[model samples]
Target: MYSMRMFLLFCVLCLMSSTGYSQLPGPPGPKGDPVNDGQHGAAGQLGPAGSPGRPRIPGLSGPAGPPGSAIFCGRGVSGQELETLKNSLAKLELVVNYDFVRRVGQKYFVSYKKRESFSRAVEFCSQRGLELALPQNEEENNILSQFFGDVYKTAWINVNTNKAEGNFEADMKNRPLTFTKWGEGQPDKSIQYTGCTMLSENAFWRVTQECFLNAYIICQM
Candidate 1:
């Protein structure tokens, strides 16, 4: 019986050696070096854009400036006042130009003492703001004739045949004479009487070819 038991025991021991048996765990082995830190990751892509901001409000305007000056903004003058001003100016002008040395009925005359040619006398009167004397009628003629009788023996009258040889015309009025006192057989049409007319001391009107003859000047206004 003892021998049989030994064989069985031997057989069990062999089985346990061939197949691993459960056992108490041993102390943990030394820890391995901690795993190296992982490599840093690549940068992330940019995020989507954000919405736009609100619009800004404008500032208020400043206060208005002061009123303009009166000289620039005053009312215009009335038409009646303007007309009165114009009339006053006209009267003032007439007064300024009323420088006559002699006067006849509704006529004003200025006699120059010096003698000059007919054209010169016209020019002289024109420079003085007057016209060469043009006796319109017998009354005017007689007045001039008497004046000449007292001073000069002869004077240039503003009558000429410049347009036509025998047709006389008043220089300023530009028409045929309304009155005449020609000497006997005057305006002879001869070369000597073809130039200009003159009033003699006797008040007789005579023509002479010598238009350049120096005679007294009488201007009228």
Candidate 2:
């Protein structure tokens, strides 16, 4: 992981104890006639610099401020608000999908179906009271689509990756996957073992081994 450093912060504060700045009692009435015997201007000695501006009291350090909501990268959100949400999710005992300090929107997401392949991911979500992430807009799509990039084989989405057989068991036998977003001309329909799946951490669907292959699963509330 990489870390970034920011410049030091210099905060100027109002010096509470600093001496007040005032002009020497106005030039004795009217300079000319020596009106009131202009009390011989006591050899005006320059006053000492106002005690270094009261040592720049660092703006009174108030009580530790509460955290803000958490936003992941690219989500575009305020830090304080994001920290608040992160804290709330932390309290609820839900796993934090990603970093909380980023300036991105981080609506909590989960990966409950761990160690399970696409098929099992469906079952995991069903029994666990969660669903796969279903991004609605380009923001969501972009966020969900560009994860781990090409580095991973493929990732799963909220979309169901099953080959619906139309609830049919024709001829007292099983049927092939009627509908699926399989890789073009793929799934080798001739093989009964293939199942619809996705490239790890991705949007498109492909065919891998049977549904029993264990992999990571991502779920959203």
- Could you estimate the TM-score for every candidate? 0.51, 0.36
Q: Which digits, one per residue and each the tens of the lDDT, describe model 2 over residues 85-163?
A: 7767663465544332112265545553345666667667667555555444445544544444343445565443333
Positional deviation of residue 149's Cα in model 2 after best superposition, in angstroms: 7.7
RMSD values for the candidates in order, in angstroms, are 23.3, 33.1
Give the alpha carbon lDDT tens digit for every residue of 110-144 in model 1.
Answer: 67466898889888978866678877777777777
- Cα-lDDT of candidate 1: 0.72
Model 2 collision count: 24
Off by over 4 Å in 2: 1-92, 95-107, 126-128, 136-138, 149-151, 158-162, 165-194, 199-202
Q: What Cα-based lDDT does every candidate model obtain?
A: 0.72, 0.48
Name the weakest run of 10 consecutive residues (lDDT summed) in model 2: 5-14
Number of the top-ranking candidate, with lDDT as the measure? 1
